[model samples]
Target: MGSGLPRSIRFDERVSERLTSYVARHPGWSGSSAANRFVDEALRMEDHPGVIFRDGPADRRAVLVGGPDVREVIRSVKSARASEPDLDAGMVVSLVSTNAGVPARLIDTAIRYWAAYPDEIDVWIDEVESFEEQSLLAWERRQDLLAR
Candidate 1:
């Protein structure tokens, strides 16, 4: 989690009760922790309209509403930017949007989210790359075993 300033706020009785209930349902989460995560995700979603958080095997991550995960979008944009050195940022986004068949807004939204939480997205990217490398190596081992 990024270093965010802690602010104290008083919730109504009803909201407090709901937070308690949510904590009860989700083990290993305290009321304060749940509330903080909820508020953070709410703020991010409000700031980025097209971004949504989804749960995966690894963890919850920001993803486009009607497209792939934000990590994928950001990675695609990075690749595009690297390959098309002559293209401007806007043009690269447009090209990625066109090729991905998603609206330019979603692409922009992913970039915006990344700007807001670079550390979170970078961790996600690293985890995925590690997983991909592990899978490939396992597959190669299997192929070698079959050859033997």
Candidate 2:
């Protein structure tokens, strides 16, 4: 991912130490790869004013600065959109903004993140849905045991 020649850029001593620590966090990532990813995330956050990337148990995700996870906001928007088919994409977001009680600006931040990385958000949505399904099944099994 370059214009050919490898380049060297200096950092503050403390910042260089921290970069090493950050590189250590990712098992298979080389220093260069991790640094590249970090720069990419910084640019993404800069591009989307109110969106930030966060680390989680599963992985890293884009989140609204003062709101819920971007995926959660997107899910709400999508569910609401399905019911209001006549509305265009923008209108459904407004409907979701009211229904979810999240400000439209925050929702827009998530929407922009979604537009940039829909595939990533969809993967997160699938993971949550799977977890919920497993929890429901576990609860039903416990209920059966209790009834007996």
Candidate 3:
């Protein structure tokens, strides 16, 4: 039940138990309220085309839109702008969509989310860059060892 309106729905025994547990763990949330929040979140996610939150490495949540990580979308757009300083948003969207095979709408959604939560995407981008640099350094070391 929500404050604005109430509706009745049936849940399986396991679902009911889980809802109860969730409400118990989260103070100030009744089972009905928790269910309402979950439903609302689900609906909101549904409205965002091609955007989904999934567990990334180490079980951290990551946003994926249009088959690419949100960071990837941001990186692509950034790189495009860097190369062509005058490219507008629409042009960037078209370029990213063509290169990434993601629809413009999805790219727009990713960009919007990135704008709202830049720190999260920046962290992911930094992690990826660090991993790549480390990998390259390791490979170079191995090559030197083999040459020696």
TM-score of 1: 0.86
Q: How far in Å is the alpha carbon of 147 misplaced in model 2?
A: 1.6
lDDT of each: 0.89, 0.86, 0.78
- Of 1 and 3, the candidate ahead on lDDT is 1
Residue 32 local lDDT, model 2: 80
Instruction: Estimate, for each residue in 86-136, the C-alpha lDDT of model 3 and write its tens digit.
Output: 988899899988998888887888887777678978888888889999999
Across 1-148, the per-residue lDDT of candidate 2 in tens digits comes to 3543576978899988998998798688777877787888899989888988888987888888878889999999888878878998778878988888889989988988899889989999999999999999999999999995
Q: Candidate 1 or 2, higher lDDT?
A: 1
Instruction: Name the regions of candidate 1 deviating beyond 4 angstroms.
Output: 1-14
How close is each model in CA RMSD to the real structure? 2.4, 2.9, 6.5
lDDT of 1 by residue, 1-148 (tens): 3456777889999999999998899888887788888888889899999888888887888989999999999988988988999999889999999988878999999999999889989888888899999999999999999994
| Per-model TM against the reference | 0.86, 0.83, 0.67
TM-score of the candidate numbered 2? 0.83
| lDDT of model 2 at position 143 | 98
Q: How far is candidate 1 from the true structure (C-alpha RMSD, Å)?
A: 2.4
| Stretches > 4 Å off in candidate 2 | 1-7, 24-29
